[model samples]
Target: MSTVIKIENLGKQYRLGQIGTGTVSHDLNRWWAKIRGKEDPFLKIGEANDRTTKGNSEYVWALKNIDFTVNQGDVLGIIGRNGAGKSTLLKILSRTTLPTIGSLKVKGRIASLLEVGTGFHPELSGRDNIFQNGALLGMTKKEITKKFDEIVDFSGVERYIDTPVKRYSSGMYVRLAFAVAAHLESEILIVDEVLAVGDAEFQKKCLGKMKDVSNKEGRTVLFVSHNMGAIKNLCTKGLLLENGETKIYGEIDDVINQYFKKSDAAEGYFTSAKLDKSEVVFIRSIRLSNQTGRATEIFNTGDDLIVDLELESDEDISKPNIAVGIKSKNGFITIGNTMLDGNQMPDLKKGLNKLSITFRSIPLLPQEYFLGIGMRSYDCKTFLMTTKEIGYFNISTRMVDLGITKPMAEEIAMDSVSPFIPYEWDFGNGNIQSFNILNNVIK
Candidate 1:
């Protein structure tokens, strides 16, 4: 297949502090020099983006020396933790932004769904917006007319087709917007995490549509999702981006494995120190270990997962609701086990409590996963006290799994041992009655 997208040592840099100052003048000068057929100005090469003691006088390198290529009919999965420059890379690919150090080459029309309601005009009716987007995508009015009803039906917003998009709910807007982009028949489709906001069933349908768009239509797709399951099911290749560089680029399975390993090594899960807390309670810390109580970050499928949690209680409370959630490296929340989901446990004592959650065998596949811890008053209807993305770990092994919940299963043996030699039994009604005698000497 032909290459549809190509990046050569792509790098994007942002200055520290604020934009628009003497820097604007310098950028203008560079633009004028380029227009005048003079050598580039900023190509003089200054310090890098590191401000450590005696370090390069710098701002920040949002992306650095990134290079990758996508072929036609390929569904490429992009995976990374937050602030991993995934969105920055997408912006560059979609031409929404420019690279500071490198360049990109594209060979076809690109339809991007980087954000919800990306290209829709809020003031326009859903029907009008569809036509407008189609036009922008180079589709003729007759072409859009042929597919108009199909798009409306797939979006499930036929009732609101004539209503202005600004009056539509977020889900409704996304459904219609995605419909227009997906059905417009663009050669290269770039989708980000916008599909997450849709309802479960719609999300499933969107994933299926994306699969069809790539496999059946033979179009190239660049999908960035936090849902590991979707990526595993849809993508044949994967690209792992970290610090604005491609860390691993190969088959989907291997790329996902490397991304998970690196994720487990990240120090903290939250971007801010002031985590989400409430008057009821708060989470102090979360840790993981194995059976022998050794602090291990790497685990195997079916291996025991010991989660230790430390929490603080604001006041004296009884029967506090405690819950632990397990999310895959890509943000697909698989298991959310809560004490409230099961029989009520003992009331949490005062002040502080050390809770130990044990999973006899983690049913997840080999990959990086996160644990989100939450707490609340048992009687309180909602789980008010919660800390998200509290901890991270990695699981790896060569094991075929069935379901998410790996409950213990067993089988019992019966004492009927027979082969060529056989025995016979008789049934009687109060009186001893024999039905057969050695099968009548084999008749």
Candidate 2:
């Protein structure tokens, strides 16, 4: 495959409090240094873009030393926490912003959807906006006309196509905007998190269109999103960014693993600060472990997973119900409540108390999952305290555990579900097969 986009040492720096270097003196100083073929004085004083901590420098590199390439027909996913410079990098690639340093090369015309209603004039009707966007992509009137009906149909806003976009809802705006960008004849497509503004069905449609453009039409795509499942599904490659710097770039799975590794929840432990005092019962800490009591976040299939929870209450209370839920990217896989099994929780004291919930012989397939805790009233009407995603755990299957040979395991198709169900195969000729039959393990 040929490289369609190449970037080397790309960076974008910004003043902390003001624009244009914050002062004319600083601007003149930068100009003088540049005129003398010297490095900008401000660049030397810039600091890493750590938003959580206060820094002494007046300039911060929103993106620093980014280097990567996108080949023809490759769909690259850019992922990071908020303020990680994912959007900045996309803007530079879209030519909406210039990098502070380094160079990039693009081999073909680029179409970008960076934000809701991006490149759309709110005063113009959606129909007019589509034609305007197509023209801006260098498509002639004839070309725009050829794809107009398809765009309108895909957007599903034909009734309002002639209505001014300023009157459209945010979702409608995104639907029309994305329809235009995706259907246009650009060799490269750049999309940021703007697709999130659309509904789930529209988002799915957009993903399909992006895949079709890259796989069927031989175009390149760059996508930025916080949705890991979507990223894993669509992108051929992944780029993980952190603190405005490249953390990992390679295979999508490896990059995603590296991203999860940075999360404190992945450590399988969490402790609440003393400063976070609650009027009612509150979680103090959470710890995950294997049946052996060794704290860990990684587990193999059929492992006994345990959760140790600590809670503190200001006053003694009766009927304090606690619930725990395990969730994957799609949705909740299982939920265990103290009331479910007719086992009432013990009365809470005025101090900290410890509790344990064990899930024996977990059959979840290989994937990342999160644990959430909720403290509710006895009737489950009021929530005293709730923390979603307190910790994360991973589950992988072993060939031996599955009672299958390595080759057979490799050949088996895995479904996208948690808590793999056990089953048996029987042939009328007196042959029967069963595997991993551990049942009723949640406790």
Candidate 3:
């Protein structure tokens, strides 16, 4: 396969609270350094793009020293948290924005859908915009006409094909814009997180179309999305970015695993120092552990999971309820509430309080899951403290350690969204059998 896109030492810098280097003097200095064949003087002062901390530098590198290559027909998934420079890299590749330093090489015409309504004229009707985008891609009028009907049909906005795109809903814009980018004759396609605006059915359709575009049509694709499942489904390669630098780049599954590891490591433990002091109740610390009471974020199937929380309340609360929820990538899988389970929490005092809950013989299939905790009134009317995702943990079955292929493990993970529960089978021939499949495998 031939290399279609090459990036070496790519970096983008921005001034704090300002645009275009923030002043004419800084711009002039940069130009002077460039003409003298010297590195941009500003590059030396920029800090890494870590949004969690306050930095002393006036400039930050949104993306720094990014290096990668894409071969013909390769689908690359860009994975990162928000503000991790995924969008910045895509903008530079799309030529919508220039990098602060380094080189980029592209071998063919590129089509990009970086955001909603990208490459579309707001005043012009969607019909005209399609022809206009095609013309911009160097397609002749005759060629645009050839693919027009297919694009309209795929977008499912045929009823409003002649409507001004400015009047279209965000979802409608995404549907039409994606249809154009995917159906056009460009050799390379770049899609950002904009697909999230569309409905689930459209998102599925778009993924199918992108898969066919690369696998069957021999075109390269660069995709950015927070949906790990979608990324795993459509991408052949993965790039993990953090603090504006490439953390990992290789096989999609390995990259995704590394991403999850980083997430679980960073969030598995928490302290009250990170919380807001204005809250009525303060959770000082939270931890996850195993049956033996050893702190850990990784667990095997059928392991007893433990949660420990230290909290303080400003005033005595009567009949308080505590809840813990487990969430997968898609959404919440199960919620354990003290009130619902008939285990009422004790009244919170004015000072420190510690709480713990044990979930026995967790039968979760191999996958990563997040934990959220909350405290509310007994009547479930007022919330004292609540956090959607405070920490994360990973569940691994014995098959993963026994050399099962990564894809096979992932397939197992996707097979069910709920934990495996104990069950018995009846043959109806005066025979009955009960088996703990997960426990047997793990034990």
In order, the Cα lDDT scores of the candidates are 0.69, 0.78, 0.79
Q: Give the TM-score of candidate 2.
A: 0.76
Best-to-worst order by TM-score is 3, 2, 1
Per-residue CA lDDT of model 1 for 104-202, tens digit only, reads 999989988636676789899999989988787677899899999999999999998999899999999888878877997789998898877888778
Is candidate 2 or 3 superior in TM-score? Answer: 3
Best by lDDT: 3
Q: Estimate each model's TM-score.
A: 0.66, 0.76, 0.78
lDDT of 3 at 180: 77
Off by over 4 Å in 2: 19-22, 263-266, 278-285, 290-304, 310-322, 326-335, 339-354, 361-370, 374-389, 393-443
List runs of model 3 lying over 4 Å from the truth: 19-22, 31-39, 263-267, 274-281, 289-304, 312-321, 327-333, 344-355, 360-369, 376-389, 394-443
lDDT (Cα, tens digit) per residue for candidate 2, span 146-214: 999999999999999999999999999888878888988899999887766777678778888888999
Clashing pairs for model 3 are none
Evaluate model 2: give its lDDT: 0.78
Order of candidate numbers by lDDT, starting with the best:
3, 2, 1
Per-residue CA lDDT of candidate 3, range 1-443, in tens?
Answer: 99999999999998888665558998899899999999878879989999899999998999998999999999999999899999899889989899989999999999886367667899999999888877776678998899999989998999998899899998988888788788888899998877678886787688889989999999999999876766777899999999999999999977877776654234446555436555677677778888887777778778777777777888888868877777887687766666555555667888887766666677776667888877788788878886546778877453455466554344446545875443332222334344344557854
Any runs in candidate 1 off by more than 4 Å, and if so which? 28-56, 263-301, 306-359, 363-390, 394-400, 403-443
